[model samples]
Target chain A: MIDIALTEEQRDCLQELINVAMGQASDKLARFLNTFVHLNVPNIELVNFDSLPADFTENYAQQNLSVVSQGFYGNEGIRGESLLIYKVNTLDDVAKILGYEPGEISDNEQLTDISSILTTTFLNGLAELIENQLSYSAPRVVSSATSSLDDHLKQLSFDWDLALKVDISYMVTDYSFDCDMVLLIPGEAVKNIQLVLERILKEY
Target chain B: MDLPQINQFLVKEINVGIIVIDAEAKVKFINQFVLSNTDLATDYQEQSLFNLFPELPEKWLKRKIESVFTLNTPAFTSWEQREYLFKMRHTRPITTENDYMAQNCTLLPMSNNADNQPELLGFIIEDATDVCFYQKQLSQTVEKLEISNRTDSLTKVANRRYWEERLAIEFERAKRHNQPLSLIMFDLDKFKNINDTFGHVAGDTVLIEVAQNVAQNLRQSDLLGRYGGEEFAIILPETDAEGALVLAERIRLGLAMHQIKVDEGTVIATLSLGVICICDDYSQYEEMITRADMALYQSKRDGRNRTTLYQA
Candidate 1:
């Protein structure tokens, strides 16, 4: 478990690194989608469980389903967590990217299929962003939307008590789609990130 | 917490609806901005989201929130593009100890000094209606301008200026290939007489008809253009003098068979044709065109309703 936290300067460096990594991800996604994609890591926050707002408890007591993937940067020595939250159907973004008239999706089965395709596409793009240094866990598909994402996170067994949340926003060509990419990294990984920066500085 | 202080501090400052619920998914916090912007019920505290935006997928929203608390991971809703004109927004679970403020749903996530769970996942909604509408208009305007520049005003075919620019390059290519370039030139048999007798309007009708007739007879690769008033030209690559003569004869016969009528029962016209094939000795495009003009004059000399080939 990581015990050290990053300084404000270090946090800034982390944000810049994430921006670069996500920018690369955007390029790959753009090529796959046959449109230009843009990625930005706008905000990064360090959070603990009890420090969280009261709404979180009220919302998750009954149902919670989520998918989480663990990736480690061998060179940077930083390990991070990626979560895919699919309580909401992702096809809205897809339809927006298609730039067509809105069509209704009546059945849950159709929503599931669309979500799976979208999740796979996003994960594939995220992998390219990390320069293949990270591998994604197979997405855990579930129907009890409330319990699934949280359940998946529990299965990963990572420390949520000492994690940094990286807030990301990505758009595919002309803001056709705007979505959130939330990455959680352990507090210990922050020290590793500092070391990586030092190494990079030395090399430069 | 003073109610007015909360409302004034909350409204319109952030770009997304702020709905805060305690551990039970009951509305614990509803900012004024959420009340004004979204269609959610105003009496939101302790009220379930299912009771509010019934149209929203409540089960999915609950699942996303639950996952965020459990894994201490921020769960995200898919980008919800507003139907009318608002910006895309999504809700994510934020857990910070000291900051009980709902998710900082601005375009930029708010920074904080919370020691414990500082994962303030903001719900960001941007207004893209104006931007999108203007961008679409810009694209349409560009397409319209492009179309107008390439179309001819009279014949609706590619204009003489475009043809001259394009064919000069083709002529250079033909010279490189050492291939024959044939030209067929035609003029209305008594175009001046028609203008004098019937009026300029009749002359124009006759010219339009002649252009259509010659255009129909030529191959797709062959070029046809109105070289000047009552005069038309055609360029046929890899065609010899004999081939050009045959094509010229076809144009003559085609025009002879087609007649344009004025106001009364009187028929309007016929056309004289001239054919010339470019040889290795022809140094310039102007020279080839001059020879074609001479052949056209010869056609008028021999008789008006037939084609004549340049013999030198």
Candidate 2:
């Protein structure tokens, strides 16, 4: 492969940056859910197309309604895919956090009404951060039904040798409340991010 | 060009479904005016009588086809010979795509062959249902006769001879224009066994149905003809190898998905496709075919029912 691997220190720096970035995403999601939101980055991987995790639907499945959004970043300079996932049941806990009576069916319409609003707010916030950092076009939201991450990779026209991957996961825990987010980064953008992180750490 | 004028012409000016079957009761040719008027729910351009109208008393039609092929006699089925008088049905084959007038059909005998004998049994259909009146009659017997020489006897599409004649011209045109031209040479997977197991009649049915389905998927400008027994060729005028590969995949998928009902069991058919794009300076069409044939063999080797494009 044409890409350079990240050193341990560089990897740590990149993870720290993503931790901060996802914190921003968590705040927006919490505000939309009207609950205290917790997002933690557990692990990140640098891999190839063949190494992607299976159970595609299960990854996004949740007790409540789920919303998944996809967008591209770093076309020329840094390139990869970003995905955001939200579980509706988790949003139920969010409703309780934002000062609504818990477990009230009649008032659930008020809770359900936030799906579009919250999805827009969180996805847009995340996209803006990536766009500013990468200097690329605005993220185009892909439909969850027809768009598979693998299909997206296959459609890419990049020189595969230069590609790198950065896969990250986010989890929300509120004692009794829970939700998750899985972020899939295309192969090329991982290398770019690693370089940027190294430069930032050296300057510090 | 305008919808209103076109609508007016289709309604008032065309009586297109007057078809005449010969004494052997086979469709010789359909008129232009009638062809436009009648919509066959399926693409039947250059199709023979049995292939297009398969359910049209095939047992009876086969005898007639044999007689026409053997006796060299013109068979005429007069307008009065119908078993029953039925209401004309208006149909648009691609209902999802466009709305068109329904066809009013009338069958008759038209003869055009080499020996000055009526070599063909024609079906003249009129488009009279929507318009409510006969507009004009178009007899393309002579034109169809010239075309028939280039057509396969069973599928009623371009025959090997036609492909040989036409591909050379298209090759020259592509070279002169520096345009992309692609060819897909394919054959039915396991066709010999199908003929061996099921009678030859069933095999013929499979060929006819497969050809019709492929014809339906092709662009109007694309040239489709049976290259030989169990093999077909499609010439895509302005397509490169990549585009041809995609088209071959589509054809393979379409055939695999379409289940042709024969009798008790449904026949699942597969195809191996070989695609080759003609280079700008291509001189001999055979080279393209050879490349395509190699790709087709590769597909079969790779596991049939797939598409393989020629590397060079």
Candidate 3:
């Protein structure tokens, strides 16, 4: 595989900043839930863009997963999407935590609402912690129904040669509440991200 | 009563349900919008959220909530995907169409202080039933309008304009795949004479019945359209010259056998059909249709109820 264009140091720095932002975001969530939240440092990968959906749920492909996505625009051609994926089986737990009795109805409106809130907080946190200001569109759920992420992959409108994949798993530590969030940065944004990281390194 | 008190007031009165879950997976707080709106009678404090909203998917909810609880990243749910996180009936002030309430839900991670002290899951649920209802109505109307525009008013068959577009598409596809394509233009023989002899009513009956007869003989993949003023056209994909000839003769025979009874007497109507197979020499789709129309003219000139093929 042609390695990602970023140097090892640049990649490590990017991961560190991403983790910082994730921590900041989890702090907001922890206060919201009146509980402690746990976060894992994202597992970063550089892969061909075609392999995104499959790479997202390689471990839990058998279970039904919900995908919510939001697009963002950044400075100096830094642009990409943040996708959130989680199993559908935990939707009941989500309804209860949200004080909803969604019942047996499938494809309900509340599903989008939950994804929107989580994606927004996440993208914003990741943006702010990296010391970059970014504009975001409202979050949307592109796939659900089946466990396969192909529907999600097929519907993606944009084109990209390569992507910087950030995979982070979060849970409440005690409960079985687990989810994976993936951030996709395109080949075009690699230079911009490197510039931002370098500037941070020099200033501090 | 500082900012937090005022914020609590807004959460209760803002017309959106607010539910907060603590780190222990217990209900921290549910605002008035949620408490008054739902059918729950018991106090929600310290209650397991799962017990209250039992239908909520256990796997998805736990994963999302705990993610926010730990990762500090917020998540969202739109009505289009999950419908309603709760089983509340639609309460929007308008016509009732939806069975369950439509809601846009937000899952927020909140920390008590600047530091990640005691964290809670903040949920904001908004009623979206009316919006969803109007959107559905709009798409349905658009679909109906589209269907009507493409259909012939009298026979409920596809109109000439729609057929022409399909013809061009079929031509390109046939060329790309190196498959044989055929066209047939059929006309009710001496239709003007029928109108003069039996009046316009009989002519109309013959036209409708002729279209039905020709359509019944053709395959499902074939396209049969009213080709303007007593003429109809059929496009057959992947069909050779012989297949087109057999179907054209079958339709001519079928129409001649069926008789229409008007106010005066029984009228026997026959159709003259012209068939042409698209050859490698032809570049434009119009050439194929024009040749079929010419062959139709030949059928009419030689004898009334016969089928003719275009000759080189």
lDDT of 2 by residue, A5-82 (tens): 668897676566655655665675554344566654635555444444344345554333333333344333555444
Q: Model 2 misses residue B272 by how many Å?
A: 0.4
Candidate 1 local Cα displacement, residue B312, angstroms: 4.8
Which interface RMSD values do the candidates have, in the order shown?
Answer: 12.9, 36.1, 6.6
Which should have the higher DockQ, number 1 or number 3? 3
**Candidate order by decreasing TM-score:** 3, 1, 2
lDDT of 3 by residue, B1-312 (tens): 899999877886888888888876798888877777778865878988889899788766776676555555556676666667888765764576888778888777676642363367888788888878888899899899999998888777789999999999999999999999999998887788889998988878777877777678878899999989898899999998899999999888887888887877888888888999989999999999999989999998998789999988
Question: Best DockQ goes to which candidate?
Answer: 3
lDDT for each candidate structure: 0.56, 0.57, 0.75
- Candidates sorted by DockQ, best first: 3, 1, 2
DockQ of each: 0.03, 0.00, 0.21
Residues A63-103, candidate 3: write the lDDT tens digits: 87777777778656778877777777876566544445556
Clashes of 1: 31
Question: Considering only chain A, what is the TM-score of each predicted structure?
Answer: 0.62, 0.54, 0.82
Minimal lDDT window, size 10, model 2 chain B: B77-86
Q: Which candidate, 1 or 3, would have the higher TM-score against the true structure?
A: 3
Deviation (Å) of A37 in candidate 1: 22
Residue B277: error of model 2 in Å?
0.4
Worst 10 residues of 1 chain A by lDDT: A131-140
